[model samples]
Target chain A: DVKVTQSSRYLVKRTGEKVFLECVQDMDHENMFWYRQDPGLGLRLIYFSYDVKMKEKGDIPEGYSVSREKKERFSLILESASTNQTSMYLCASSFASGSTDTQYFGPGTRLTVL
Target chain B: AQTVTQSQPEMSVQEAETVTLSCTYDTSENNYYLFWYKQPPSRQMILVIRQEAYKQQNATENRFSVNFQKAAKSFSLKISDSQLGDTAMYFCAFMKHYITGTASKLTFGTGTRLQVTL
Candidate 1:
């Protein structure tokens, strides 16, 4: 089974604080993605890494950055957290463009910025 | 940019009943993949079913199936004999098919909240 685990299931932070969300996958997938889920907008991609040290900005990349130092781990960083940044963050992993086209998602982290 | 639209915001059905959720996408690419993802309360999201655009036959997984219309750029999910466990947020997603190593990003609909009541 492909297991994608997030560091925290819930988080609380103050405004202007730096936050980090970690994700790890056991399937050795080459693609890792970070997405934020909002009520009306659904899940919007923040960033994705295709390989180690290679990252690409998704539709909503502002105020966020990602790190992929290794194949199994991907990290999402919030430079300056704001109240509007409070949303459910989800991590996903998938095999590099192959027969397996589906992405396995981690239990999301709901962050609250006060 | 590809856009996926799920016009239904919420839906309810009794147990043992059937429900179909609608999804429409705007894209120019002919070769791509469409997916239905289910996210239950407090649990991680999971792929319910996926249909490749090039494949004429609809993809089915047990009680879950999809109606894919390539020309119309529409894809919908139908759950037969809906159960309580089927209650969740259903999101329709699109991803361009690629043979290379880099996987394409998935564009998702706003999601339809489904409730399977007694």
Candidate 2:
């Protein structure tokens, strides 16, 4: 079985504060992704990393960035946390060999910005 | 760009019954992948089932099965003898097939919330 774990399950931050959400996978997958899930809007990709030090902007990349210094770890960074950034954040990983591979997800982190 | 649509926002069904969730996608790509993901109250998303556009046969996993229509671009999930554990938010996703080593993104629908009642 594949295991994807996040650093925090819930977080609270003040406006303009810096926030970091960490994700780690044990399956040694080459692709990692960060997504923001909102009601009625579903899950929207924020950023993804294909390999170490290689990152790509997804559909909604503004106000967020990501880091993939190692194969097992992927971090999502908020430059300046705002109230609008409060939402459930999910991390996923999958094998890079085929697009048909299933992406395993971690229990999401619900961030609250005050 | 690909878009997945799940018109049903909320659905309810009795335990030990059957329920079907509808999903439709709009994409020009002939070869792609479709998936149904279940997000329970625990907030952990799990893959329920998947269907490849190239395969005419529908995909099934235990009590979970999918109805895939290529030309109609419709993919629906049917759960037989639904249990309380089946209550969750179901999301339909679309991904374009790429060559090996190419990272592909999944376009997800605004999930349908299912509540299994007694």
Candidate 3:
């Protein structure tokens, strides 16, 4: 079974503070993603990494960035946390394209910005 | 951009009953994958079932199944013999094929909240 784990299940930060959310996968999948889930808005992608040091902006990438220094780890960084950034963040991992593979998600981290 | 829509916001069914969750998507691509994901109170996303757009037959996983209407671009999930454990926020997603060594991104629906009562 593919297991994806997030670093923190809950986090609180003040406005303008930088925050980091970490995600790791045991399956060595090549693709990792970060998404912020909101009611009525659905899960919107923030960022995604296809390989080490390679990253792409998803639909909603403002005020957020990602890091993939290694194959097993992906990190999401909030450049300047704001109250609007408070939402449930989810991490997911999957095999590279052409496999008809599904993304395996981690237990989400509910971040609160004060 | 591909879009997924779950028109129903909430649904309820009694134990041993069946319920269906509706999903619709709009995309220009002909080849892709559709999925139903369940996120319980634990907030862990679990894959319930999947259907390929090219396949004419519907996909099923035990008590979970999908009615895939290709031409209409509608995919709905059906859960049979609902249990307490079946209560969750169910999301429908779509994935387009990416290039070699690249990642395929999934666009998810707004989610339907399912409640199973006695």
Candidate maximizing DockQ? 3
Flag the better candidate by DockQ, 2 or 3.
3
Please write out the lDDT profile of model 1 over residues B41-95, one tens digit for every residue: 8888999999988899999999999999999999999999999999999999999
lDDT of each prediction vs. the true structure?
Answer: 0.94, 0.94, 0.93
Clashing pairs in 1: none
DockQ of candidate model 2: 0.73
Q: How many Å off is the CA of A4 in candidate 3? A: 0.6
**Candidate 3: segments with Cα more than 4 A from true spot:** none
* Residue B87 C-alpha lDDT in model 2: 96
Off by over 4 Å in 2: none
Judge candidate 1 at residue B99 and give its lDDT.
Answer: 63
Which runs of model 1 end up more than 4 angstroms from their true locations?
B99-101
Q: Compute the lDDT of residue A77 as modeled in candidate 3.
A: 95
- The digit string of per-residue lDDT tens for model 3 on A1-114 reads 899999999999999999999999999898999999999888999999999999999999999989999999999999899999999999999888565578999999999999
- Tens digits of per-residue lDDT for model 3, B1-118: 8999999999999999999999999999999999999999877998898888888999999999999998899999999999999999999999986667668899999999999999
DockQ-superior candidate, 1 or 2:
1
Query: For model 3 chain B, where is the 10-residue window of minimal lDDT?
Result: B95-104
Could you give candidate 1's per-residue lDDT for residues A1-114 as a string of tens digits?
889999999999999999999999999889999999999789999999999989999999999999999999999999999999999999999988555768999999999999
How many backbone clashes does every candidate have? 0, 0, 0
Preferred candidate (DockQ higher): 1 or 3: 3
